[model samples]
Target: MSNTVVNSAGAGLVRAVPALVGAAGFALVYLVSGSISSAFASSPAPQPNVSGEETRAWLIENATASAVQAVLMLVSVAFLALFVGAVAAITRSADGPARRWAIAAGTAAVASMIISAVLSLLVGGLAAGLTPDAVVALRTANFIAGGTAHVALFGLFALAASRIPGMSRPVRIFAIVVAVIAVGSLASLAIYYASILILAGRLLGMVWCVFAAISLARRLKQFPPA
Candidate 1:
């Protein structure tokens, strides 16, 4: 094979790294940490209301599990941040709509990370000490930061990516699908089935992360750095 072909393959593999990391992060959070948290929730110690007393009791009962899950989630956020950065880097040189959309997506990703960090830290560290109002505030922030901003931001990013010239049909569709699912996170606002909807959205979004990671990996393997 020609030198060009060899270089292209190498590049494609390199590109896949961010996607891989993102996928792993998702698995860690939604799958592994999720399982742990689920156990806690199922236990009798868990309560539905967002009260300081309940928070303290739950924390006391599931302290180890909660802490572990929080750490895992925090790591996942870091990986996701990396994923966003990688995507932005890939699109940084583009002009026009692609550029605008990619920029929006990256900015949104950063903001989402900031919000997630705060939420995760609070859950992991200060659960026992929070006031009732603080607990309520966290829930409100979770909806906007986690549900609204996160999905909407990523959706905009996907919109931009899907329009990039010469982008593959599969990848474009994948972005669109992921963005829509993420936007579904807003279902967190609902009273009856909020957790179910949010979880579903997040699980669906995992498809994007895994697929994107594989695609980037393939691209890195096939292409050369400019």
Candidate 2:
């Protein structure tokens, strides 16, 4: 097999590991939190006679889910690192529009990772003092930074992946859709549901990441080690 194929395969494998892991983490957090929210909505409002212990217990229970979300957040950062590494490795073969996009995507990945780390640190510091308003403010910032990064990185990935030889047409089309979604999500940031839109965009972005990894892996397998 050729060097191109080998490189692509390695990149793909590296990329896939984090994506699958992150997706699992995301699913776990989503399910747990959504369930809790549903339960809370269905339950009766607190009675005037309710004890302090009961309230504390409720908070503790919610905290458990929050802890799970924190773990998922860290896993997501790991995935971003893997994505950046894969893009760096594959960018060498890219030229023209593809090369430019790779560079931009790699840079955005790095920025996104950095911002995520910062947000995590901030949340940890404020965890004890967290109120609904404070959480909303922090989450707003996180969504803005995260959404911008996703748009930049995914847009680049779509452009670069579309140019790669042997990549399937469907993968290219998916990339295009991801790029469009990212842009639209960014535009929607001015609205109250920005977080929701951004989350949706990131989910779509994950699909593109998986496609990229598979394509790169297939290329790599076609090329053997020298």
Each prediction's Cα lDDT score? 0.62, 0.54
Query: Which digits, one per residue and each the tens of the lDDT, describe model 2 over residues 46-112?
Result: 3213443443343344544434444455555465555655544544444456656665775675477
Off by over 4 Å in 2: 1-68, 95-97, 127-137, 194-196, 221-226
Best by TM-score: 1
Using all chains and alpha carbons, the TM-scores for the candidates as numbered come to: 0.74, 0.60
TM-score of 1: 0.74
In lDDT terms, how accurate is model 1? Answer: 0.62
Top candidate on lDDT is 1
**Residue 223 displacement in candidate 1 (angstroms):** 7.6
